[model samples]
Target: MQSSTKTPTAGGRAAPAPWALVSVLAANMLVDALEVSANLVALPAVGAGLGLPVPQLQWIVSGFAAGFGGLLLLGGRLVEHLGRRRVYLAALLVFAAASLAGALTDSAALLTATRVVKGFCVALTAPTGLAIITSAVPEGPARRRAVSLYSFFGAAGFCSGLLLAGLLTAAGWRWTLAFPAPVALLLLAAGARLVPRDAPGTRAPRGPGWHATAGGLGLTGAVLLLVYGLSHLAGPGREPARAAAAFAGAVPLGALFVAAERRSPRPLVPPVLLRHAPLLRSALGAAALNGSYVGFLLVATLHLAGSGRSPWQTALAFLPAAAPLALSALHSARIAVRLGPARAVAAGAVLAPLGYALYPRAPGADPGPAGLLPATACVGAAFVLAFTALHLQATGSVPAGLQAAAGGLYQTFVQVGAALTAAPVAALYTVGRGPALWLVTAVGAAGACVALGGLAHRGRPRARARP
Candidate 1:
């Protein structure tokens, strides 16, 4: 792999600073994470302004997930085939444009469309940025630190988005949409100066064949349909028929994608990644963390609302869950080195369920912020311990050239898993919030089991790069 520690400039002048490159990438990741949580707070305002029903309002959030989760794998390939810097820059430009358009739009459908467009843009940038970090920062302690910093930005962004959304909504929901445009532009300027250009020889010698292209398209469509279905189940409309149709349609598309991969000279997903146990476990662990957190957020907010807390108050109450994540960036590298990534992940996974189980189960029980701290703090600790480790486990095992694809796969699991887990949990909310919490706890336990399972193969050595 080419050294990203420093790159030669054309003028032989001082090169762009390495930390600057990482900051540009990490900041963009913050933008992506912010988008996911921010709009959710603005959903009611959006519905009131656009005169849309609950179902359409739900799309304002779900549309982004569908587009992002669906396109990630293909976006990763594009980064591999094209250059990471090229794709990253172009995606940022499009993201800025989409954010601007979203802010100006009055039509509900147009707002959702812009969200989907921005999601596609994020689909390109998020993994590309991750791939850049993995390739640029050599493996071992340095890479762990870099990955931890990247993961911290994401966790912090999600937390920041909620608070920002609360503040911005008072000005009007459009500000929520408008906020990221300038942020993207700023990142774009810095990225152009900072992100190293892809080496001339970095591009693939040959592009995907017709079979691979077909398989890629099929796989993307299948993922889109599946996520869309799963997301709608949790939407306020609760349109089971539409969700069922999407689910039913995805089966055949997925089967065809599998068949095509078998026949293609170059498959959409590398076969080696398929057999990689560590990556798979990492993906599942991330899924459990994200899904349960999302579900808990929904259930917790509803519980708080029942106690007459305003949305702003609810956002504040969750601070315990988000603060540790940002701080974790500083120490996660040490934790990973000390405990091993797998063990760290498993240990963190165990904490989440314990926290969920500790949450006050009765609807009438109004746990003040202080009472809620233990639960939220535990969830936050889970992220501190596991989130960065999960990223490390996912990409560390893959070849440097395939880092982007591995990132895409890992993120896909995270996004789609949130939808899948949150759906049934949401449905169970009507039955009882306690059951939803139990479900989230169960998922966390299952994730912990999966991570623990990876520990059995004592003879298998870890994949690493020599510094």
Candidate 2:
């Protein structure tokens, strides 16, 4: 782990320096999320470096998710137990070391190990960043703004990573892996200087227990099985025997996770979260919405530029979608406050699929600024609206103590949605651009349906958002 140089704050406590502090927290979360897709543009380079089989490549990234997503709850607990300041610094150092190691390594095993380690660091940091937001910024708009920045960075980092990876991979794969090192260094320095210090809680648990470890292992295996099963069965050219086996494999793990969680004393994921009636469905909506939303972005980009679209044109087209989000986000809080979170999320769900429905009608037809622009704008804007509302609805419903865990659970669902349709989403572009997009649009509608049934109600002023 990389060492942090923290400064003393009020009460002679070690803390991060104050100055647009929310931006700093957002930056940290953004960096972590971007790593999810950071290597995509450099896949060829990384594959060569690691001597990877074509099939093994996804593991390089999925392994990180396996590490990060699995440990997120544990990471939050560790932060509470050890003190956010210490955990934040230690996690940054780990990330830095892994980034450096990734840059220097040629061995697939070594690079993948570093990625997994970095992911572990990221898991620790993400929830802690929100915790920091809650602690540092007082409630209401201040914290809301901070969280907005965090979410915004996440969106921006993902988009930027693709662009940056493209540029760097053109130079060499090392640049893509190495790019994060300097940023990590800067973040470490800033974090040490600015983040506030809080002493370890006397009552906080010592560390993660077997129950927690088992929970993550069980849950991840279940999710991976589920993803593989669906991917193979529905995806093009998929083998029947293998797909059947994958489906068979997923069933036991899913059942085991449910049974295990129901009994564990120190449960990996607290069962209460899974049982939250409104959240259970809303989280599914968030996952489904994002899965198709990001899926569209991935395939749309590939279809546009995968063949011959120039870098500038690709950037230009995406920007139209990107630009409206910032403007629309300014109104998200107000809309949620007035309209309620459930409706807000449902509205976004409708808009995204609606945009997809339009794709076929107006395939490549220049509909001027209002026409072509609004379609993608709906996709991005809906993302902002739904995700923000999900945060408000899911987290706000929970007791204060359970907020981080709830947030993590919500995020896990989002990842599940994203993971489920990789092959199906791929088939869209691989099969035919128009047909593939329409399929994605239909999937988006399916997600909207999930949101509408469970978490998709209206007009009740509930708890306000947590930063």
**Top of the candidates by lDDT:** 1
lDDT of each: 0.77, 0.67
Please report, as a residue range, the 10-residue window in candidate 1 with the lowest summed lDDT.
458-467
Q: Can you write out model 1's per-residue Cα lDDT over 4-35, one digit (the tens) per residue?
A: 44556688777765666777899899999989
Tell me how candidate 2 scores on lDDT. 0.67
Tens digit of lDDT per residue, candidate 2, span 1-467?
Answer: 12235567566976553335666778887787667555655655676667664334444555565566555655666665678888988898888888888889877768767866786798788877777878777678666666776766766776676667667766777888888878877888888877766744532666655655566667767666655554444334456687688778877877776676777775656667766766677777877786676566555555444445543344455665555554555566777778778777888888889876665333454333444566787787777667778768777678876775777888777766665644456544444567667767877898789767644344434443232
Residue 275 C-alpha lDDT in model 2: 68
What are the runs in model 1 whose C-alpha is more than 4 Å off? Answer: 1-15, 47-61, 106-109, 130-151, 205-212, 231-240, 305-307, 395-404, 427-432, 455-467
Model 2 residue 461 distance off true place after TM-score fit, in angstroms: 12
Q: Mind sharing the TM-score for model 2?
A: 0.79
TM-score of candidate 1 to 2 decimals? 0.84
